[model samples]
Target: MKKYFLKLYQYNYWANKRVLSALTSQNVSDEKILSIMGHVVAAQYLWLHRIQGLPPAEVKLWGTYNLPQLVSMAEEIGTRWLQFVESTDNFDRELTYHNYTNDPYINNVENIMIHLVNHSSYHRAQIALLLRQNGFEPINTDFITYDRVITGQWKD
Candidate 1:
């Protein structure tokens, strides 16, 4: 289970980088796209803090960040997530954390990880649609796409 979760996180990190690269390469400055990406970043951080047993801090869930800043933070958070999961041995431990609205909830470590991956994928698809609507080509960030890239099956 841990190994599978690690692959999911890895695919997540890769997909995010591809999306960020597309945003930068295409000069995507759309406010909506940036805002959605910001939420993606913020949610990761928020959840990271929670699973680390730290209290949630007030953070903007949907906001815009400059491309460079967003890229830096995304990479930093991705690395931290990988480290956190790798270092931890307990996946079934239940954690209690509050949402930004002060609502409380409980979830296990593994479920949280799964949620993060699904959450990111859901938003990435949104970003892809928005990019297409804006006359830009969306980079493929599917998990199979990442696997093929990893396994040397991806063609330029």
Candidate 2:
């Protein structure tokens, strides 16, 4: 399960980088992509905040930044998330905690990690679909592909 989480995190990091690359060389206004990416970042922030039992921070409003700004935001968020994973001890994975909304949640570290990955994956898929509808060819974003890229192994 820990390996799965790590693989997913690595995959997400590369997939997001690809998306940011695709955002370049397109004639579409920055507003379109930036807005979508902002939502992804905001969602992660909200969930992380909730898990930490903290109030949600004010999210950056959409249509407020250029493509570069959005890319930078994604990079920063990604770096922080990876750092959090790195700092977490193995035993902590099973610890439980409540969300900011006071909802009962399995504070198990593994579940929370999975939630983060799934949440980001959901939003990235949405962004890809939006890009396709807008005539931009969405990049191939597959876990297997990411595995190969990061680990140099094509294990099935």
Candidate 3:
């Protein structure tokens, strides 16, 4: 489970960089980019806090990340996640915690990590869609594409 989540994290980082590079190329608005980047950062922070029994993070604007700021924040969060993973044991998958909304959650570690990856993927797609609607070409960000690129495995 830990290995799977680590693969997911790596995939997420790779996809984010590809999309962010495209976003930057288009000279996207500062506010929109910052908001998008910040949303991704906040999601990671929120889940990490939840996993560690820390207080919830304050909400931030979505779809509004400045290119440079978002990239920096992403890098920092990625590092933090890697560090956190270093201490994760197989038993972590069974740990449970309550979310900020008071919803009970099980499979604490894996679930939260999956949530972080999925959450970011959803929003990053949104940002890509926004870019496409504005006449820019969004990078291909499918999971299989990531897998193939990272692992050199091709699927028909």
Candidate 4:
């Protein structure tokens, strides 16, 4: 399970970089695009905090961030997630956390991690749609694409 989570997180981070790079390289200054990406990073941070038993009272779900800031924060949070996944011994540990609306719920680490990835992917698809509507082609972030790229170039 740990190895599976590590790979999924790796793909998450890789796809994020691809999305960010595509936006920046195309000089996309769309406020909505940046907002969605910012939310992605912020949500990752919030989830990490919750899983680690840290307070996330100040996290902004729709914070405004420029592409540069998003790039930096994305990398930072991605690295932190990788480290956390690497260090955690049990994925089944349950955590109780409150939602932005102050609603409480309990979920295990594995489930939360899965939610994090799916949540980011959901937002990424939204960004991609926005990109297409704005006259730009969306980057292919499919898992198969990532797998092919990595296996094609990576030697173990």
Taken over the whole model, the C-alpha lDDT of each candidate is: 0.88, 0.66, 0.73, 0.90
User: lDDT of candidate 1?
Assistant: 0.88
List where candidate 2 sits over 4 angstroms from the true fold.
Answer: 30-33, 50-55, 60-65, 90-107, 153-156
Give the top-scoring candidate (lDDT). Answer: 4
**Candidate 4 residue pairs in backbone clash:** none
What are the per-residue Cα lDDT tens digits for candidate 3 across 1-156? 768877787778777777777777787764664577688876787777667767775545344556787777677777777777766766255657765567986765766678779988888888777777878888887888988876768541
State residue 35's C-alpha deviation in candidate 1, in Å.
0.5
TM-score of each: 0.95, 0.73, 0.78, 0.94
Q: 137, model 2: CA deviation in Å?
A: 1.5
Residues 53-144, model 1: lDDT tens digits: 77673457876688887899899989988898788777888888788888989888888889999999999999999999999999899999
The runs of at least 3 residues in candidate 4 whose Cα sits more than 4 Å from the true structure, single-residue gaps closed, are 153-156
In terms of lDDT, the poorest run of 10 residues in model 4 is 147-156
User: Can you give the lDDT of residue 50 in candidate 3?
Assistant: 66
What tens-digit string does per-residue lDDT give for candidate 4 at 1-156? Answer: 999999999999999999999998999989999999999999999999888888783658898899999899899999999999999878898888897778999988899999999999999999999999999988988887888888896321
Candidate ranking under lDDT, highest first, comes to 4, 1, 3, 2
In the order shown, the candidates' Cα RMSDs to the true structure are: 1.3, 4.1, 3.6, 2.2
Give the poorly placed runs of model 1, Cα more than 4 Å off: 55-58
- Candidate 2, poorest ten consecutive residues by summed lDDT: 91-100
